[model samples]
Target: MVLRNIMIGIIIIVLVGGIICWTLFSKELREGKNLPLTGVDFKRLADGTYTGTYEGGRFKWRANEVQVTVSSGKVARIALLKSTEGRPSEFTNELYDKVIRSQSLQVDTISGATITSKAYLKAVEDALLKAQK
Candidate 1:
């Protein structure tokens, strides 16, 4: 009986430790400390239609889509087809302007919604690549 109680205590301790570690790691990742951006080649894209996707990783809901259209080697329009609520939706509109005006996905990530910004940028990049192909 004593052994069983010790084992239970150990398990509880381990579980709690794991939860704490995950929480800390997730926060670090969301803050862009643990997560590193692997920049994609956006210049390969030509004038055409593209499909993009963005997943917020652990920060927000996974799965998002963007439709991109390029004209004269520049972004003509960017449409956020789908995204999670909160920051994602708010940033989507802002992204459209930034991308179109800048003609690139290298714009700054949305303030306060960093993860969502990353996801949106990824999705838009994917769409632009699709259009190129």
Candidate 2:
């Protein structure tokens, strides 16, 4: 009888934990999808290297940091310094190239990885904001 009760208790705990994890994951995804990104002006940025970070300010699933190098009043290079994915994923790599190429945050996100692309972009934007004069 005691063993049965223990098993039931374990099951209940597992179910509750699963529910909490799912809820948090869903919330983070929703927040990422609706995240607002203000466009920064490249011409106004100073020539220097800047670092930026974004941790969603709440759920940290998308936490990341990036280094942006500006030269001659333009973004010359960008390096993913840190990320939850251990490094830049294919989507993030592609997105970073797009950001550097266009020099804008208005670039299109990866079709299926919009949240991830935005997460990395947010980090890059955080860094670029510091570059603004």
lDDT of 1 by residue, 1-133 (tens): 9999999999999999999999977775675544564474556568898888867566555457889887777778888777674556567778678756664556545455456677888988998999896
RMSD of 1: 13.9
- Show model 1 residue runs off by greater than 4 Å: 1-11, 14-17, 20-44, 58-62, 85-90, 104-133
Cα lDDT of model 2 by residue, 1-133, tens digit: 9999999999999999999999988887888898887888765889999999998446566788999999978888888888875643777778888888887544354455446777888978997998883
Each candidate: RMSD: 13.9, 13.0
Query: Which candidate tops lDDT?
Result: 2
Q: After the best TM-score superposition of candidate 1, give how far the Cα of residue 90 lies from its true spot, in angstroms.
A: 4.1
Computed on alpha carbons, the lDDT of every model, listed in order, comes to 0.73, 0.80
Task: Please give the range of 10 consecutive residues that has the lowest summed lDDT in model 2.
Answer: 105-114
**What lDDT is reached at residue 98 by model 1?**
73
